[model samples]
Target chain A: SQQGEEDPQALSIQEGENATMNCSYKTSINNLQWYRQNSGRGLVHLILIRSNEREKHSGRLRVTLDTSKKSSSLLITASRAADTASYFCATAPSGGYNKLIFGAGTRLAVHP
Target chain B: DAGVTQSPTHLIKTRGQQVTLRCSPKSGHDTVSWYQQALGQGPQFIFQYYEEEERQRGNFPDRFSGHQFPNYSSELNVNALLLGDSALYLCASSGGTSGRAYNEQFFGPGTRLTVL
Candidate 1:
């Protein structure tokens, strides 16, 4: 079973527009990380936000976490055509092991 | 520094046969983990190896096993392959266990495995 679930299975937007993807998880996590994957390829780590932190930013990427709600959201500002890919949210449990539990993911399409 | 690398970009095996996939961790990394991603789904954790020992595992069956060499490279072996076992096998590497520092995992290109 998957611990995290991403919403809006798919999304499409213009190059200069902003894209937002949401993820909800069942268990408590020490941190939540977002990754991007091209077709049939491995994942690239985007950003990681710890449970203690409410928000984090990297370049044009912004991530917000609400531990109380057990949810997180990733926002890409000024999206580019190259940003088209699948985005996955993964959660690392508070303790036990450092393994990551990933969500199905959100397919984002950015058009020029 | 070289990133994580997996052997045999692609492979095919029969239903009753077995297959072995290899992975070399990135420079400065000491831990390796494996994942299986099916079409249109997220990657599922298979297991993790550190210090030449199996540290943690997911809900996979005993048929899925792995080994970590002294050099920190690893291999994933699947016995009695099934059609449902077909998927992209991904290998990720990270630094050794730190006291809850939230290490980031770097991934390899992955090997596409198909079972007939």
Candidate 2:
């Protein structure tokens, strides 16, 4: 079964707009990570936020995790057309192997 | 350093036939994992290999078996393939550690397997 589920299956916005995506999970997790994938390409690891951490930032990518709610969100600020891709949230279950369970991803379209 | 690499960017096979997909992990990485992604859906975990052993497996059946070489590269073999088995096969590499917090996995360009 899938552990994480992302909301807003699709989103479209003009360039320079910020894109935010949400992910909710069922079970307790040690960490939540986000990835980006271009069409017909491999997934690129973006950011990882641990359970102890509330928020993290890498360049223009910002991620927040709320263990109390078992949810997390990814924010891409000042989005550009090159940022158009599918974003996924993955959860590493607590007290188990570090295998990552991925969510069904949100597709973002940045129109230039 | 090269990221993960997969062979045969695309392949075509018939139902009931067998297929073998290969992957080479990133340099200095010892763990390899495989995933299957269908159209319009997220990638599903197939199994993971560590130290040349099947460390953990997903809900996939026995038909989907894999082997990891001493060098850490791995192969995913699917026997008696079905049409539904056709999907993009992705390979990811990471260091083998249990509780080290953030261990980001690097992925390879997936192999598009088409079953006819």
Candidate 3:
């Protein structure tokens, strides 16, 4: 079953602009992670935020989690053309931590 | 160190035939997980292996199964395949020592399966 659902199935933005994507999940999770997948390539781990963490940042990426609302958002600051890719949010259910249930990703196109 | 690596980058099989996809985990990693991603959709977890055992599994039926070798490599096998089974099969690896909150998964370029 799909655990997470990402909003704004697709987004287009110019370089240097900020891009944001939101995710909502059905059940409680131990942690939420964000990954980036280039065209026809594997997914790369980006950032992870625990249930207790309200927000976290890594370089140009900022992730916010609200366990109460079962929602999260990923923000990319100063988006670059290289940052264009499909971004997905995955949630590991509280009890089953080994497998991740992913969301339908948001495709972001950063035009240079 | 090499990241997760999968074999048979692309494969073609007919409905009702079986297929096997291989994966080698990153050095020093022991856990392996498999996922299926259909066109324009998110990946759905199939199962996971650790310590040469099936540690966890998702909602997939018995037709889908996997095995982990002593070397920490794994293979996903789909039996009695159906046309709807065609998708990109992904292999991911992560260390078991890292707690749930800190574990980071490394994924390999998925194997694109085309079921005719």
Best candidate according to DockQ:
1
Model 3: how far residue B102 lies from native, Å: 5.6
Clashing pairs in 3: none
Q: Ten consecutive residues with minimal summed lDDT in candidate 3 chain B?
A: B95-104
Give the range where candidate 1 chain A is weakest over 10 consecutive residues by summed lDDT: A92-101
Q: What is the C-alpha lDDT profile of model 1 across B1-116, one tens digit per residue?
A: 79999998999999989999999999888889999999999999999988889989999999999999999999999999999999999999987656234678889999999998
Instruction: Choose 1 or 3, whichever is better by lDDT.
Output: 1
Model 2, stretches more than 4 Å misplaced? B96-102
Number of the predicted model whose lDDT against the real structure is largest? 1
TM-score versus the correct structure, for each prediction: 0.97, 0.97, 0.96
Expressed as tens digits, the lDDT of each residue in A16-82 for candidate 2 is: 9999999999898878889999995899999989889999999999999999999999999999999
Ranking by DockQ: 1, 3, 2
Model 1 regions more than 4 Å off: B97-101
lDDT of 1 by residue, A3-100 (tens): 99999899999999999999999998988999999986989999989889999999999999999999999999999999999999999888745688
Candidate 3 per-residue C-alpha lDDT over B1-116 given as tens digits, one digit per residue, 9 for 90 to 100: 78899999999999999999999999988889999999888899999888888878888999999999999999999999999999999999987574243477889999999999
Off by over 4 Å in 3: B98-102
Model 3 clashing-pair count: 0
Model 2 lDDT per residue over B49-93, tens place: 888889888999999999999999999999998999989999999
10 residues in a row with least lDDT, candidate 2 chain B: B96-105
Evaluated at residue A52, the lDDT of candidate 3 is 87
In order of TM-score, best first, we have 1, 2, 3
